[model samples]
Target: MSTDAERLGWAEQAAEALTEAGYRRGGVRSAIVALLDEQSCALSAVEIGEALAERGRRASRASVYRVMEELERIGLLARVEVGQGIVRYEPLREGPGHHHHLVCERCGRLEPFTDDGVERAIQRLSERLPLEVSEHEIVIRGACRSCAD
Candidate 1:
């Protein structure tokens, strides 16, 4: 339920953070904003670049990838890989219980899932597991409804 303006502000803030982190933000700013405006579920860098190109915006592939990395560093997006080499990028929520995702391997569809139980279990595991867990991602991958149908 975020307005486009709000998303732009978020992107700008993210860009500022990137600058602080020493990553320069350049022409790719529009590409990042366009991705937010489209609100595509989860996109790879190439996919983002193609989306901008469809709208007559010439977002260079390198710029799109750099923008994505900067956005990830600023906590504006989450990077997820579904047992594949391609990393998917999703906008981050400003509140707790960041929704999990279910990914369709064949169709590349992403569906959001949320449950307090998941958070509790993650916390419990962090306490016991040897891994240092700050943030975690959970993705269930399989054929989706339509694909199965």
Candidate 2:
């Protein structure tokens, strides 16, 4: 979980980005961005709507999806497909410091991890290949410790 201050900072940054992109900072969008900022893992659109409702922030499913898509368009969110047709969204970090996911196939648990060696290897591969790699996502699927136990 992120500290309250950290989450607030993220929300502020997202609002600034939205404003700069010529979008108004409406109530629903603000709530959705705040929710995404506080989350440590990706969430589906339905999940996001439910969460907002739980907090007394009512928003229609369509509105939620639209706002999510806008956030993704502005690079504030990343859409992750962990398989089984389940699409999830998570906040994108500021720059190249973004992490990848380790998903537990059995329990559907998602964990974020970062490794300098993996980043270096990707850079080396990019250099060796003719294609210029702008970004990458690694999703390692296996049983988690609890599921294995």
Candidate 3:
């Protein structure tokens, strides 16, 4: 969603969003958010820390990890394991901030999109599971249409 404050990028929006969700934010949190946006990829905690350092914005490894864990616990971020020991965090929200991703493994491209079939599937699943699924994101990683050539 486009909030006047949300324009500051994922790191800034994350701090605001988390605070609205009842988490007290600090530099580490902001740094983590920026790192996520800069890398624009699903990254492990260590990778995140390293990236921050490379950008001349250093955050303690422990703190970086803690923020990642806390975000997940607070339901603001989702931990996805796309490969061996590789976990990354992604924000989830409906309305304007909602969508899924198509990750190109070969090209390292992340494409965001939403589809009706996904919505229908979630509705179907909620009926069978008896739990309210607010939103769902599917990361389909493979060759893109052009890459299929």
lDDT values, one for every candidate: 0.72, 0.84, 0.68
RMSD of each: 3.5, 3.0, 4.4
Clashing residue pairs in candidate 2 (N, C-alpha, C atoms within 3 angstroms): none
lDDT by residue (1-149, candidate 1, tens digit) is: 55656666656766666678776556667457556645736777877888788878887788787777767766778877854677888876544325788988987777878778988898898999988866777888999999889
TM-score list, all predictions: 0.71, 0.77, 0.62
Q: Write the per-residue lDDT of candidate 3 for residues 100-140, one digit (tens) a residue.
A: 77776665555667787887788788889867766666888
* Candidate 1 CA-lDDT value: 0.72
Q: By lDDT, is 1 or 3 better?
A: 1
Candidate 3: list runs displaced more than 4 Å: 1-24, 34-41, 101-113, 124-129, 139-149
Alpha-carbon deviation at 86 in model 1, angstroms: 2.8
1-149 per-residue lDDT for model 2 (tens digits): 45677667777889999999999987899899888887877899989999999999999999998999899998888787766777789887634336888888887777888888998898889999888866778899999999999
Candidate 1: regions farther than 4 A off:
1-9, 37-40, 73-76, 94-97, 124-133
The local lDDT score (0 to 100) that residue 136 gets in candidate 2 is 78
Ranking by lDDT: 2, 1, 3
